[model samples]
Target: MRSDPALIGPLLERIAAWRAGHAGLFVLGVCGAQGSGKSTLVATLAERLTQAGVAVAALSLDDLYRTHAERQALAREVHPLLATRGVPGTHDVALGLATIAALERGEAAALPRFDKAADDRVPRGEWPHAPANAQVLLLEGWCLGAKPQDTAALAAPVNDLEAREDPDGVWRVHVNAALEADYQRLFARLDRLLLLAAPGWDVVAGWREQQEAELRQIGGARVMNPAGVARFIQHYERLTRHILSEMPTRADLTVRLGPNREVLELMPGA
Candidate 1:
């Protein structure tokens, strides 16, 4: 999908206003549900900022996923579901923290990249280098700044995936614990967070399905079929819904989107 100038214009204005209040290496977090266009918005914003003479580096949480071997070990030690890459417990939180720290310190750092098609991280030699003097860092992710659900919320199954795979709630509890601990430390680095709020969780599967379709057209190995897409999204459903219910008020700015993915309203964080 193309970038929406109508939406980007207002967002750029707000970001400029937000940047003015902060000094020295601003960290902006862009959060959204699957297929909500977080990467598109971040890319457009980074391009605009670069044209304005700012040194910007954009990173996706997807790139910080644990290596395949690491995740396999997690699966062996933790739960079988930990083998999946999309959830909180599957990320390399320490690496994320180190990357942000290095950037803030104006040190040259090589950012890691994950090869989703291969289900592993690319070699360090293949990684991209972020400039030492970046003025702004844009970190985008599906679950960035997502708060953990309470114990009561985890007692019930949200879908068949949860009901069958996580019947005892082991996986959900593990994911929530990661959110409360390591993820919280990582998110605290954000000076401002912009959330692309989907209309509701019900639309996420359709949006993700559309994304997989596009990927398939391009012959992407990671592209999932319709049924696979449905099952895959179940891993994200709980936190995505929690962010929908919680992050709008907590984020520095939130761009609400309708079913058609058009910007509906922009709300300032509380």
Candidate 2:
């Protein structure tokens, strides 16, 4: 109910149409910039859709990030930047695909959860078990439906994180290469994609600051300082900009938002 009816009504209609035509789970990918409220939107959609007699399950791509130790090893073997989460190469794409396969096969699946405080994945046994035979599955993330950028685009550093820490271009190139491979396999499973398009990258820092304040008030662990938010978001700047440019036309539905996160327009994908 917290989600706008303007967006949710049409999305529900699409889900119903998809559910009627195709059997089994319909993977609905929801893409939004950090702090753009995509998770809240998905929560509302899941609640509303279930009330209308649809069996729904929700999952976040962040839940599939590799463990802290795994990332440490990658940092040693690959590049130092691999140690930080949020980039494509840091996720365990095979696990994500496997979970989707299990759900599609009408089997109970373990839904992975990542602890942002711990900065690692919650153990498998501790994961919540999702029931089989779902009619719709919500797979949402900051870059869920993003396409890989051209190799040439990776050469220029988008921000200070790339300029100073990744002066050699190893991290961004690795991330783009990752998007080309397993991430595509993961994104390919989506039956529909909806983008919550932020007006521009300039708005993200303020929104992210809002998220941090809420988390601190709620005592969420590992919340970064306000200064840290600026530096941290730099890790996502490249693909996020890339998605802002590329995904609006490609997503099945696009909900354009103002700097204040208000809906500006809604349009069907090209």
Candidate 3:
């Protein structure tokens, strides 16, 4: 249960190595399962880098979620599942691409932020601009470098949410298609992808429920109880499993986590 005191040190080393040869704007992805502390890792890294006089831009994939109105319209037009904000199809990938482009070009890019309590993006003017030429840009998300499942893989429902709600596979297919297209393009911009892999999906579920509990303690809005957490998590279960199995082999670095979020294994990807 004890955290690895040296976790950040080695990561900074690896990032320095990546930056050594990169031409400009080293985009490092801090990808992890839900409630697995991707944001904490990025924040810690940004602080460490800043202390050492490095410029960094910190962002989150959750920030790219489409507006609540946009998602509601999608739900009416596409499938009812499109109304949820966590899935791939719910994000505005074009905005993500454009923002990253502006940062890479040494132009001020307003980093987006989503108000999870309200389940919507905060106004654009409220977004703070990241100065140009940041030495490192950290974009963390649950699915930062994830890929779509095979079409054949989608034929079977992975959980009750898929079986009972999306029996025809339409909703899941739409998510995968988005992942294959725009998500991939956005992911391609990452100079390095660091995966924070949980022990398994069960652990991820526990982590998410714990998150909900903490949020509720603070009277956070739209907070779900454990049962609701279970149902809501099913929306992400399929791809969560896919990334846990697939990303370790390909991520620039993979940090396996214990049940308590302690670092268990750190493998440099092939």
Q: Please, what are the lDDT tens digits per residue for candidate 3 over residues 55-174?
A: 789999999999999999999999999998899999999999998888888887899999987889999999998866777899999989998888999999989999999999999999
What tens digits encode model 2's per-residue C-alpha lDDT throughout 145-179? 78889888888898988999999898888888998
**Candidate no. 1 TM-score:** 0.96
Q: Output the lDDT of residue 6, model 1.
A: 62
Candidate 3: which stretches are off by over 4 Å? 1-4
Q: Who wins the TM-score comparison?
A: 3
Model 2 scores a C-alpha lDDT of 0.88
Error of 2 at 239 (Å): 0.5
> Taking the tens digit of each residue's C-alpha lDDT, what string does model 1 give over 1-270?
246776788777887888896878899999999999888888888888899888888899999999999999999998999999999999999999999888988877788899988999999999888877888999999999888899899999999999999999999999999999999999999888889999999998789989999998999886788899889989999889888998888888888889889987888878
Cα lDDT for residue 269, candidate 2 = 86
Q: Count of backbone clashes for each model?
A: 0, 0, 0
How many clashing residue pairs are found in candidate 2? Answer: 0
- lDDT values, one for every candidate: 0.89, 0.88, 0.90
